[model samples]
Target: MASIFTKIVKGEIPCYKIAEDDNYLAFLDVNPNAKGHTLCIPKQEINKIFDMEEDHYLGLMQFSRKIAKALEKTINCKRVGVAVVGLEVPHVHVHLIPLHDMDDMRFQRKVSLAQEEFEAIAKEISKNL
Candidate 1:
């Protein structure tokens, strides 16, 4: 079975896309810690971040930095925080969260947004990228 991220990459599942390239994809996290929280992942569907090749790992970081910068410009926050906890899903995903304070980085709390809002924010971040 394919991971959910792979399904999203293959178009089986829908996503509020932020950016994409031949190797990577960025999109808004449906259940976000903040309004501009986004996930950056390699389309290859590797289960763990360290298992990726060095170049592949760096590429993810580079792509994630671009998304983080765009998120900083598109969303209101002090800075963008990064987290890479792979337990929830068996895919290498980098979480780019818009941080107002320390608690925003904690996954204990979450923010809800309407579909239209997700679309609009995705568009804004895409525009910035």
Candidate 2:
């Protein structure tokens, strides 16, 4: 079965995209932690981050670092935080969140954004990218 992130990558579902290259895709999280929270994933589905080949794993990090830089440029938060907890989804994903404080990193809190807001945030991040 394909993961939801896989569906987004294959265009089976829509996403507010921030950046994409042949190997990776970055998009705004619909249910965000802080505004501008984005998910960076490999185009190839891998169940675990450590399971990825060394080069591929490094590629994802390099790819994510680019998105995080863009997020920092686009958002007003103190800095961007990185998280990787594959429990919620089968595919590997790197979470880049705009953090205002410690709570931003906690999964307990969720932020809701309208479609327009998601689109705008995606655009701003992409522009920075």
Candidate 3:
């Protein structure tokens, strides 16, 4: 079965896209931790980040770095925090969160945003790319 990220990448599901390349995709999290919170994933569906081949792994980070740099410039935060908690979905993904403080990255906290708000944030990040 295709993972949800794959569905988003393929346009089976709608996403607030931030950036993309031939090998990777970056989009905003609908249920975001912060205004510009985004998820970066490889076009290939690998179950674990470590399971990816060396070149793919390196490409993924390089791809993500581009998005992170844009996120830092666009979002109101000190830094963009990276996190990988693979259990939520079967596909490998990295979370790029705009961190104003330590609590901004907490996975246990509940965060919510309207679809329009997410779309606006996505547009802002995309413009910075």
Candidate 4:
């Protein structure tokens, strides 16, 4: 069975996409920690970050760094925060969050956005990429 992220990669699930390449995808988190919180993941589903090949893992980071830079350009924040806690979903994901304070990266607080807001934010971030 495919994971939710794999379904998104396949277009079986819809996403507010920020960017994509042959190996990876970046998109807005529906349940976001901050307004511009994004998830970057391998196109191929890998359950654990460390379980990926060294090259594959490094490639994901490189891919994520590109998205993080774009996020910094598109969102107002003190800085962008990176997190990799794979327990939430089976697929490996890098969380790139726009941080104003320490609480923004905690995952305990979340923001709600309308569908139109999500689309606009995704478009703006893609433009920065």
Per the 3 Å backbone cut-off, how many clashing residue pairs does candidate 2 have? 0
Give the better candidate number (1 or 3) by TM-score. 1
Candidate 1: the clashing residue pairs are none
Off by over 4 Å in 3: none
lDDT of 1 by residue, 1-129 (tens): 799999999999999999999999999999999998999999998999999999999999999999999999999899999999999989999999999999998998999999999999999999998
* Per-residue lDDT of candidate 3, residues 1-129 (tens digit): 999999998999989998889999999887777778899999899999999999999999998999999998888889999999899999999999999888889975547888888888888888988
Candidate 3's error at 114, in angstroms? 1.7
Q: Give all candidates' CA lDDT scores.
A: 0.96, 0.95, 0.89, 0.96
Error of 3 at 96 (Å): 0.4
lDDT of 4 by residue, 65-93 (tens): 99999999999999999999999899999
- Candidate 1, which ten residues in sequence have the lowest lDDT sum? 100-109
TM-score, one value per model? 0.99, 0.99, 0.95, 0.98
lDDT per residue for candidate 2 within 17-41, as digits (tens), equals: 9999999999988888999999999
Estimate candidate 2's alpha-carbon lDDT, on a 0 to 1 scale.
Answer: 0.95
The number of clashing residue pairs in each candidate reads 0, 0, 0, 0
TM-score of 3: 0.95
On TM-score, the stronger of 1 and 4 is 1
